[model samples]
Target: MTNLDIPATPGAAVARTEASPVGRVLAEQAVRTAAAWLAEFRKSPSTPAAYARDLGLAAVVEHHQLQDLVEAFPLPSVRTLFTRSRARGVAPELCWFPMLLDLGLHPVLDATPAHVKGWVALMDEHRDATGQPVLSPAARARRVAALSSLLRWAVTEELITANPVDRLDRDRAGLVVDRHHSPTRGLSGAQLDLLVWTADRYPGPQRARTAALVALLATTAIRVSELCGLATGDYFADTGRHVIEVTRKGGKRQRIPVPPAAAARLDAYLATRPDYGAVAVPGQHGAGRVPLLATTAWRPGAGRRGGGQPLSPGEVWATLRRVARTHPDLAHLADQLHPHQLRHSVATRLLEAGAPQQHVQDLLGHVDPAMTQRYNRARDQLHNSPTPLAGQLLERGLAALDQDQEHHPAG
Candidate 1:
């Protein structure tokens, strides 16, 4: 490894060129911080490897993933590679994160342009036994973005003045990763209606629960993990409005306002559930607050008095699949539909209705304004929807307003 002396105060000439030392402890801390950052910025729509190609949250994520190539590289030589001890991913949301995180033995400094170029060359040339390619071009791009992310964060904390990775990123070709325009694919309002309607008509005690689940999935747009975390005690209602107190990813609870229709569905479901703090009994979630939604298997155990347990994520998916399967129109989606897709569907609807991007971002817990803009842009470029018709309506409305002003001659 080549050592580049880092100046105490990096001058303008060496600002983006200097290399500062990063000890094993700092590298490990960076991984933890990077993970928290990714979770907070997960809703950002841009791909760090492709679109931004610079220091950003996505860039951190994309770059950090490569830090864990520990199996391929030893910890002592490449301390910069975050060896993750043995955990594959830092969080469940990002299981794809390479498990190569560790508090390595040496110090890692800020990457220089030469360092980035060297890393790229290694990725391109290095191959496992049998000459099989290890990191694909796309994978390499992701890790580069990941590295950029860490350096960018380092810069933010004033740990580094600039991210040298930016210098080499411009020279690299085919560094961009292929990305889907919209992960929702496109959830039309009609299909969303069918999803809710199908669940609503379910002929069982859990019918209301399923209906509420689908409705809230589309309307509230909470993550499935958060949905499953809901307890009977979480639903807060007042004379003015109804809201669900959702436990966010880090156990931070936030009250998300629910529309009247969805709230009504929730009430209908709770009408059949056991009271909060149901009597002590086995199979109950915690012998505490009952789950807002329960599985059919969670019957009245022993004396039919126990509070049913929270519905598992698997159960939620099963219910969604059942809803899709029951409706012939939605049958094709049975294998493809997921709860998160509905969240996207909600964003689409909100943007289509001309809601402010910031308001929508707040509603969805998106930290980046770029994601909100992407959602609007996706809706704007819709070829399937009646965008042309809407344009025609606008033109006609403007002309009608002009004629009315001329005829009426308002004072």
Candidate 2:
């Protein structure tokens, strides 16, 4: 076997020769193929880079002799692939590499249709670090779809004769794997109230700031990352409505309307800061580049150097968790609650209160209506009542008995 030379950087171009190791050649070809496909498909910049890294790792694990590696690859599986991949900083999607490694299926030339179905079964029985099932049915389905895409690309390139994954009946797979729509669990009204109350009464030095942060999260449904990225200039009163301009996922800018109560809490929190009034111009209200949620680590001698640094997503999570841990009412949710749950809660609350699906979709900044529909379906299921149907049946049966007794004059 020839010694393999892996590139230090994924973006670096490598010159290949006829003498180059089979694994290296295969890896380079796969990356080139993926790049060409991505260019034509116009995928996000990060997609090609990630695929290059992942495929390169796959090449290394197989030692470049694709045919021999696939036939002899361990079936029951060990963590060797994962450990090696991590050392090279080429961690693929969770369980993706391991599943492939365990199957030892050749990507292009050798793997058969039965091998693909066997892989599906393996994923179904796989366990996580916590001893729970590794992938939910939906998650498994997504992973399969991703794998199928890659294989289909290989087939188009004529590297493979056919795409075996395409032969697997999707409807049959769905029947075998129970596909349930798992709704995002959000904080209930009581949970939200308790969280805010706890934050307000926190004895920590950053109590007021924490209170405001919780209030904003509960009301706005903005992601923690977006909240952390906010600048004071982003918050302003527009036409009698308090609004905050935020950059959502995928760099989309959105103006989210803040609730009056939450705005008041934010104002009170800002008033406690010495720089708030100084930063604002006399004519313009809420106009400054200062971070809306600045770090609490600033001290007098720090000389404003650390003052404007925004609270990180980790800090936001820790703050909420601290409040949940301290409050008796929220103690049960201490382990389960997080900032994203607040987003889910807001979405659910809006749908339950008769908000239009499209309006909620816009509020959440979801590009896909299907995602918004999940929230609507969950709300509908929650409110659907069996009592009405049961009540009608009972009433009809009782009325029939009453009429018979009256007509027969039973004594």
- Quick one: best lDDT, which candidate? 2
Error in Å for residue 99 of model 1: 7.4
Q: How do the residues 162-274 of candidate 2 rate in per-residue lDDT, one tens digit apiece?
A: 88788898777662433234345777755666677667778867888988998888776677767876877778765556677776544445666676557777998898877
Residue 387 error for model 2, in Å?
32
Q: Cα deviation in Å at residue 240, candidate 1?
A: 1.7
| Candidate 2 residue pairs in backbone clash | 23-64
Off by over 4 Å in 2: 1-123, 128-131, 138-181, 271-291, 296-314, 367-370, 373-411
Q: How close to the true structure is residue 121 of candidate 2, measured as C-alpha lDDT?
A: 65
Task: State the lDDT of candidate 1 residue by residue for 1-411, as single tens digits.
Answer: 212223222221221111223333343454455443343333231221111222222223343443553333221212211221222212212211221111121111434566556556655665669896566665567666666766676677676678767888533545664343443555776576667767777766668888889878867767776787676766765345566666453334455666655777777877676564433222222335567786555453323323365565556887899888987789998987887787787777667767556666666665556765333121111122222222233334445645765899647
Please give the CA lDDT of all the candidate structures.
0.52, 0.56
**What TM-score does model 2 achieve against the real structure?**
0.54
